[model samples]
Every structure is written in structure tokens, then in C-alpha cells.
Target: MLKIQNLHKSYSTPQGPLPVLQGIDLNVARGSSLALMGESGSGKSTLLHLIAGLDQADSGSIQVAGQDLGQLSESQLAGWRRSGIGLIFQQFNLISSLSVADNLAFQARLAGRHDRHWQAELTQRLGLTQLLERYPEQLSGGQQQRVALGRALAARPALVLADEPTGSLDEASSNEVLQLLLELLDEQATTLLMVTHSPRVAARLQRRVTLSNGRLAPADGL
Candidate 1:
């Protein structure tokens, strides 16, 4: 569902251009999950941003469902993102004033594909039915992250990009969150590309690839 070919991105600095992603070639299959592992400053998040249309690559192509991201105008990209991509960051990013129910329904409403039935099911499956009336600040980190996932998936986006999704939780919470994510992704046949530093986290995905020096490489067993 997603493809990247020789993609390159760099940032301007006092010391000249700081190359981040160099020749990043990757392809993610439909209904599959991939773990992107790398050390700090390895450009994993940069690659995800490019694919999500939040940032443009300096060179090469990032194609999602046959559409080249680089070619889209900012307005077009905004629409594209609303329709096709679901993003979950390390931070919950939930609206502080919105209750869980509103937070979960936010994305679907924006995409104009709000389905009460689907959102209901997601809330139940994510074990968030009771918390619908609560706010983000009232929940634990894992609970908040589950709410974030619910918000993202509520739109039924074809692809999900998660950057260090479980980075803020404890081990048990991380495992629970990851398990729920896999189960939901399987049920919906959604594609996932998550950036994480934990081997335990990466090992659960269908495949893992390590990013190094702005390039992709097959990672040996964790």
C-alpha cells in the first residue's frame, strides 16, 4: 500500500545541509505491519513524516496507494492525509477538553466518514467503553494511548503511521497496548508502519527493518 524509492531528505543548518534520510527504499504490503527500528537521529521519524505528507522529501518518490505524495499540493495533501493516513505519535495528542468519545470520533468526523457502528466496536474492543465519559488527563498513559489509537482507527484509514507508540508506558502497559494494536489491525486489515527502539516491540510485528544513516537494512533477530 506504500512505497518509497531512493527517498532523500535533509535540513539546512549553520554547518550546511544535514542529510537525514538518504536513499530510503521501502515497500509495505496491504494489511501488514512493519517495525522501523533505529537509534536516535537515524531519520526514522523523518521518513514517516514524508510518507504522511507532513513534510516533503528532498528527492525521490513516496507513493501511497499509487499516488505520489510529493506531487500533491498542500491542500490536496491535507485531504489525502485525512482520507488515507492515520497517525499516532508518542504523545497522546488528544484534545484536553474533549471526552474520550469525542476524541475517538474526531478523526472520522474530519474525514467525513464517521461511522457510529465502527467507532462503537472500536471502543468496546479497545476496552474503552466505560471511559468514554472521561478525559485524557483522567486516564493512565496506556489508557490515553488506547484512546489515541481509537481516534486514529475510527476513520478507517488505509495506513497507520506510529512513531514510538508505546514509548511513554511501562513494560506491562506497553505489551498490552501493542497486543491491542495488533488485534485491531488484524480485524480491520489495516497496514501499520511503526517506529520503535524496543526489540520486544519490533519483534511482535510481521517484519522489522532497521534504519541507519538514512538507508534501510534488514535487521537480524532481536
Candidate 2:
């Protein structure tokens, strides 16, 4: 579902240009999940942002679901991201004023693929049945994360990009959330590219890759 070739990115600093990703190449098959592991400043998140069309790469290409992201204009990319991709962040970026149910259905509605049946199923499966009427501030971190997950998957997006999704939860909660996420993704046949710092987390995915010094490498021997 995702392909990258010769991808490069850099940022301007007072000192000079600082390279984040250098000539990165990666390919992820549809319905497959891959873990991206790296140290801080290794460009894991940068790659994710580029793929999501949140940021432009300095050079090279990113293709998701056969669409070349670099070719799309800003408006086209925004529309594509709304319908084609699901994003989960560590911060649980839910609307403070929206209730759990509203938050869950937000993305699906925006994507114009909202199905009441599917949303209800997701609510039940994610254990958010009773929390529907409550706002995000009323829930605990794990509960909020579940809501975020539900929101992302409620749209049945073709590709899911998660950035340290479980980073804010306790160990037990993290494990539970990750397992649930993997199970749902598998059921939906969605492709996943997750960035995580934990080795244990990376080991759970079908494939793993690591970034080091702005370069991509297999995690096999890391």
C-alpha cells in the first residue's frame, strides 16, 4: 500500500541545513503491518509526515495506494488524506468539546463513508459504549486512546499511520491498545506503518525497519 524511493528531507538551521532522511527506500504490501523503529532525530516521524502529505520531502517520491503524493496539490493532498489515510497520534488529538460518539464518527463523516452500523460496532468493540456521551476530558488516557483509535478506523481508511500511538499509556494499557489495533487492522485488511521507540512494540508487527543517521535499514540485526 505504500512505496518510497530515494526519499530525502532536511531542515534549515542557523548553522546550516540539517538532514533528517537521506535516500530512504521502503515498500509495504497491502494488508501488511510494518514497525518503524529509531532513535530520536532518526527521521522516523519525518518519514511518516512525508507519507501523510503533512510535509513535503526535499526530493524523491512517496506513493500510497498507487497515488503519488508528490504530484498532488495541497488541496488534493488534504482531500486524499481525509478519505484515504487514518492517523493516530500519541497526544490523543480529540476535540475537547465533542463527545466520544461524535469524536468517533468525525473522521468517517468527513470521509463521507460514515456507516452507523460500523461505528456502533467499533464503539462496542473498543469498549466505548457508555462513554459515548462523555467528553474527552472525562476519560482516562487509555480510554482517550481507544476513542482515537475508533475515530481513525471508523472511516475504514486504506492506510493507517500511527506515531507513537501507545506512547502515553501505561505498559499494560499500551499492550492492550496495540493488540486491539492490530486485530482491527487485520480484520479490515488495512496497511499499517507505525513509528515506535520500544523494541517490544516493533517485534509485534509483521515486519520491522529502523532509521539511523538519516538512512533506512532492516531491523533484523539492529
Top model number, TM-score: 2
What is every candidate's alpha-carbon RMSD to the true fold? 1.2, 1.0
Stretches of model 1 off by over 4 angstroms after superposition: none
Query: How does residue 7 of candidate 1 score in lDDT?
Result: 90
TM-score of every candidate: 0.98, 0.98
Which predicted model would earn the best lDDT?
A: 2
lDDT of 1 at 133: 99
Q: Model 1, range 1-222, lDDT digits (tens) per residue?
A: 998899989999999999998898899999999999999999999888889999888899999999998888999999988889899999989999999999999999999999999999999989999999999999999999999999999998899999999999999999999999998889889999999999999999999999998788988752
What lDDT does candidate 2 reach at residue 154?
94
In candidate 2, stretches whose alpha carbon ends up further than 4 angstroms from where it belongs are none
- Sliding window of 10 residues with minimal summed lDDT for model 1: 213-222
Residue-level lDDT for 181 in candidate 1: 91
